[model samples]
Target: MEVRTPWQALTRPLAYPRSVWPWRSAGYLASSVVTGLPALVVLAVLVLFSVLLVGLPLLLLAGVALGGVERRRLRIAEVAPAADPHRVPDVPGLGAWLRVRAREQATWRELAYAVLHATVLWPLDLLAIAVCLGLPAALLSAPVRLALDRQETKVVKAYLVTSYPQAFAAALLGAVLLLALLYPLAALAGARAALTRALLAPRETELRDRIGEVTRSRARLVDAFEAERRRIERDLHDGAQQRLVALTMTLGLARLDAPPGSPLGDQLAKAHDEAGQVLTELRELIHGIHPQVLADFGLGAALADAADRSAVPVDTDLDLPRLPTAIESAAYFAGCEALANIGKHSGATKARLTARYDPGPARLTLLVQDDGRGGADPDRGSGLTGLADRIAVLDGTLTISSPSGGPTLIRVEIPCPPPSA
Candidate 1:
């Protein structure tokens, strides 16, 4: 199996030595001096002159820059890429960028990491490389040192080697030591990579904030949709519906003036009847688009109006105050659909609709129950599936309990803002 992390590679004692991970780890640790040294110099200078007030901002800027670089550098030992936790500025320019970075927790964490790295981590990295790699290299070059000097030579600045055998022996020992130390060196590199990722990657709280922003955006879209529906409803009610009513009245007046039993009188009556039917259909269409009662009174009266029109006899026990428009719309549509289904397919004589609102948690619950030959399944192309999805967008739930024999119940519960007083 392929290994992605140093710790995972360490688990296999044999194949790890043969893999390319050792070189990768060595490279990661060796490169620490590149960024760490510059960071140390910059941080020291900024602190010394920070009384000027300019140094503080520059220091933050430096930290932010270093954070970007370090996140990229983590790719050496970490297979998974680190995501930048700072949000992009709304407007472009250094001023907006700085303002956004200053407000992010990632920026502060990066600054702290930079400080710790400059003071402590770089020295440790340097020391580990020197002892683990440099020492072995020096020992392996013992025979060459002796030959070049034509005399005695100090092995690793400690053991003295005078003869060829001693020089050769030191070289052999160096090779063995180099092989043994690679494991710990790779392990150390893995630890360093993990620390860098922790400071630079997105945090749990930042992820939560991002999810919240997305939900609010969806809610805004739902509100805009409802507003557009209301606009269309208003236009039809005040424009086309009113014109049709006037036409119907004019046709009625013309029919009354015509001679009784004449062809003209029969034609006028037929035209008047057609116009009246058209007006009634338009009124129903306007109401379906968005009920004016819902906008004027609220969900309670709107559901009552719907119950009065349902083909299946419905008894309602609802005591609710005004709610958010989106919530009210969703609940109203769900109730209307339930009653329509009952009238068309339930084969029941009566249905009951119940609604209640709890102020403690500010939740609204509506129930529609019908005593019918019941086997309602949303998966079977039922309209309840659409109702469930719409409710889900508002962080509400739709549940149906329908046995095969009788009595289908649909319950909707939504957390909403407190009703307007």
Candidate 2:
């Protein structure tokens, strides 16, 4: 069987020689010796020429080249392919590429691996191949050597073989040694592949890429949510709200036409009153889903409308340019929620809504404060938790400060550019 990695070959002791694993392990280690020598020469030259500043770029180039070579070599002993952690430069220029590479941790890690392979790892590879494969082959030739010399021969320079029987016995010992050494050979090769992966793999780069993807995905979800909200609002306005208005109109006309003091007249009046009430409730529900004022006139006007509708009298001092739809929606809803909470829970009879847009930082700040019995806890179903999550999607912040005595304040800040006229 063809095992991809040394570890897999190590597990099947009976099949070690019948398969290509032994030769592969030998080739992998032998190749390291060849690759390691050039690395040592290049690194040594780079260090010696450091005073000329000519070697720095060459050193980086060598490290990068060696990193590629190491990853390819890992295939001889690893089933899984090593991942490349280097990022492509955003701009296509040497200077841009260098700057990007210099900032990456992967570049330095590869350099360290190159240095270690040259100084330490290659010699180990050579020694492992020699001890595991070479000594056994020498012993297997002991009988032939004894016959040719017509005298005793030393096997591996350790065992003496004078007669044919003793020479054959030495050859048998060599065969047994070769079989025993196969497992250690596989183990050493596996360790070398693992070390190569650890040094050359781009694990940190992959993590950063994944985090960026998650952030962008979250932004997309928030955008899709807002689009759905707008669609619902449009359907209600153009379909259900218009139908209810027409129904109310029809009932009003019927009530006027009905004869006075009659049962039919009283029934028409009741139906008309019920339709008008239902229409009013539907309008409120539609506004709650997504306010039309906020979409048409922007956040400042929407805040003023919300304050006017509050049970507690609210004063407004908002000055903002039109902003991005997502920013405006989050800020408006946060304000509305704070106001609703104040009216229901806070005993404060008066509230103030203030908003301002700062051009310098491209930020919008909204504050809602009330003189009410305070001590509000978001964790206790205060509804501010959802608002905080919404603000976070825009890379914004929501803060609440409510003392036990009175004066609760809710502040929201969102980073977004002011809308163009």
Candidate 3:
């Protein structure tokens, strides 16, 4: 793949490779270096002559534009480094625009970018243009001169050199050296631009800020997950588990006193049956909160159980090794949600679920497909949103494709598996 870096895109293209004219190349490089400088000088000159131009109004409007430019510059700086893009704000009216410009740090940064855009980019452009074109022109000059003049095998000039052999050697050497410099100079200019943006802008601070935000988000997700789990555990243990245990004891006692098929025995059996039903529902509820199977049997088993519970006939195709609880939980839960969505809304008869681990990509991907009237819109439900959050915790991705027809597919890719332990 050909990768053109942000700095190279902005700077080098202006001068180099535009035309092969040697003097023009030199002039381009010179112009590139001076581009940002001239902008800065103009801004400064304008500041001094603001009153003369249109008093305070022109300076104020210029300042607003300068602010927008500064914001744009910062956004560029951040993105140019593969960092977060702090986009420029759209300020609607003149008053809003003025306010945005006046109130933003980004504005100043953008103005500085414009100024540096001229100062730094111009010279590099000039240099690149000069080196790329001038040496070739100098080398090729003797040949063209030979053809145009066609005077002799040897020609006399005010300088000491005259032989065709000497001219050929000189021209060839110059061309080789010129071409040799191209890559290194291009690389250096690119590096210099990166360094320049880092130094001139607040990219370092912005990176730190983005890192901190990501950390906080992760922490919040962890805390929230734990809190939800604890709440569910409390409900199951105190409310349902306790009730089921009592019912079991009661049934054991009733079984001892009563004989089979008697009226009293039948009544006790009915209560006993009710207890089991409640127990099953409670288990389902607890699993819904956070599947204990995910902890015990890993991702594959949990999804299998989900498929079993699903009302629709599910064809499960899954093969996976034991994975960490977190990864298994995310995968299992994501699958569960997708399948649950399919069961609830999909009117088709056949549904299929598959989970496979790709060790090479280091991803655990799951697919839930249904031959149903597929019209699942994420906008209408929180199930997909919560699934998104779960996968995001693992830095994974989720995608659903459900046209309003007979087939629907839900695909989830967890890029990095959780800690193996």
The best candidate in terms of lDDT? 1
Model 3 spans > 4 angstroms off = 1-201, 216-220, 223-243, 251-274, 417-421
Model 2 per-residue lDDT tens digits across residues 261-334: 99999999999999999999988989998899999999999999999999999999999888988888999999
Candidate ranking (lDDT, best to worst):
1, 2, 3
Ranking by TM-score: 2, 1, 3
Residue pairs with colliding backbones in model 1 are none
lDDT of 1 by residue, 13-33 (tens): 898889888888888888899
Candidate 3 or 2, higher TM-score: 2
1 against 2, candidate with superior TM-score = 2
Candidate 3 structure quality by residue, lDDT tens digits, 4-66: 443443344545444232222233334444444646576667667865864344444454454
